[model samples]
Target: MKITVLIENTKGELEDLINEHGLSLYIEKGNKRILFDTGKTNNFIVNAQKLGINLENIDVVVLSHGHADHGGGLLSFLKINNRAKIYMKRKVFGDYYSGNILFKKSIGINKEVFEKYSSRIEYIDNFTEIMEDVFIITDIQRNHKVPEGNKYLFVKEGTKIVNDKFEHELIMVIKENKGICMFSGCSHNGAVNMIEAVNKLFPGTSIKALIGGFHLAKIPAIDIFSTSQDEIDLIINKIVNEKIEKVYTGHCTGEKAYNKLKQGLGNKIEYIRTGSEVQI
Candidate 1:
């Protein structure tokens, strides 16, 4: 199987492709083509065109989460692949907000998209199999202390804004020829949590690699997660201890966290920017 980064947080060698604060990946194996998590803008469509990828031909489209940076481009994507079934958790359409009232922003998918394309969406609230080897692991269990670093995010409930439970978050786990490859969008559920969840789903199947955001990187100036160093340290230790061979991370995984992972995991930490490809 091979994964092509359609859109991420940066522009790569393909200079024409626009960069946005989001994530989108095109995964292909055998006859199957999967478009995972469209980025926050139509940049993915433009970028995909430049990369020689046909958005209309995707076999399956999966929304890893409801965050704007993750699922904001759904309507544009649906235009190209209108008939394809989009896999997502049921709560993706709920209202989401970030930051305080002074600068809060709506971050969830546009619910009206569901009204227009209801038949094309498959809402999974539990573990599900999209095909023979492709699986969607949903409702990530927080068995460990490593919460998905999204404390600043909130969900609207009546007149109140409560902490986002992230119930809508899910991941794509593909069983490759050699082993398992997990794609947890943004990994707000945390890398270790997502990996462990996949491992549990496929018992004894060693996870060879994982791609997508780790959410470990923080904006120090905002103090949103200034003390994430210890969390990154422990997460790195867990990654090494779990024997995950390689990791391609970006999006919300700020540069500080990437460097930290590089310093600790060395070559195991790979980059996932726009136009990059990973084959396994």
Candidate 2:
């Protein structure tokens, strides 16, 4: 499988490529062409063209969650790629917001885009195999610590704005010859839990790699991470114990947290930036 970073929070060595506070990966597995998350805007589309990635040829588009940074490019994608089926979890259109009661900002996808492309969008509420070896798992176990940053994320329930449970998040697993590669958007459900969920679903299958943001950064303010040092250590410990071969993380995973993880995981971890590419 070949994965190309279409857009990310940081720029790559290529000067032409642009970066944003989002994530998007162009994946090619066998005959299947998958686009995971579209970053926060049409910038991903622009970056894809520079990387020689034809978005029109995408066979499938998966929105990691309701967050705008991940699915905000839906309208642009729909305008360019009409044949590809877009998949997202149920309730992904909920009014997702970030910040405390004093201040909040909309962080969810544009409902207008969803309404316009409703025909092309498929809602997956349970474990589903969208293709032969490509699977989407929504039953993420919450046995481990969720992102500390999640406390600030809210979803509107009736007239009350409550803490987001992140039921709209899903994990993508692709079975490869070596093992399975997992793709997550922000991992609001927690990376450790995602690993365990995949392990339980596919017993005895080795997890070759995990890609995407771990949501370990401080929200509203990115200068410092919201996750405590102990929590970061615990997460690192869990990833090491799971024996995941490689972990490509960035975007919501703060720089400090990444460094901490790097110290623990050594060369097993890498920081993914725009124009980054990985082959598994």
Best by TM-score: 2
| Model 2, span 1-280: residue lDDT tens | 9999998988889989988888899999999999999989999999888777889999999989998989888888899988999998988989999988899999889888878888998999899999989999999989988998898899999999999999999999999987899999989999889889999999988999999998888762353677788888887888888888999999899777899899999999999989999989
Which residue window of length 10 is worst by lDDT in model 1?
218-227
The all-Cα superposition gives candidate 2 an RMSD in Å to the true structure of 1.1
TM-score of each: 0.94, 0.98
Q: Candidate 1, residue 266: CA error in Å?
A: 0.6
lDDT by candidate, in order shown: 0.81, 0.89
Clashes of each: 1, 0
Give the per-residue Cα lDDT of candidate 1 at 204: 84
**TM-score of predicted model 2?**
0.98
lDDT of 1 by residue, 81-105 (tens): 7667899998888899877656677
* Clash count, predicted structure 2: 0
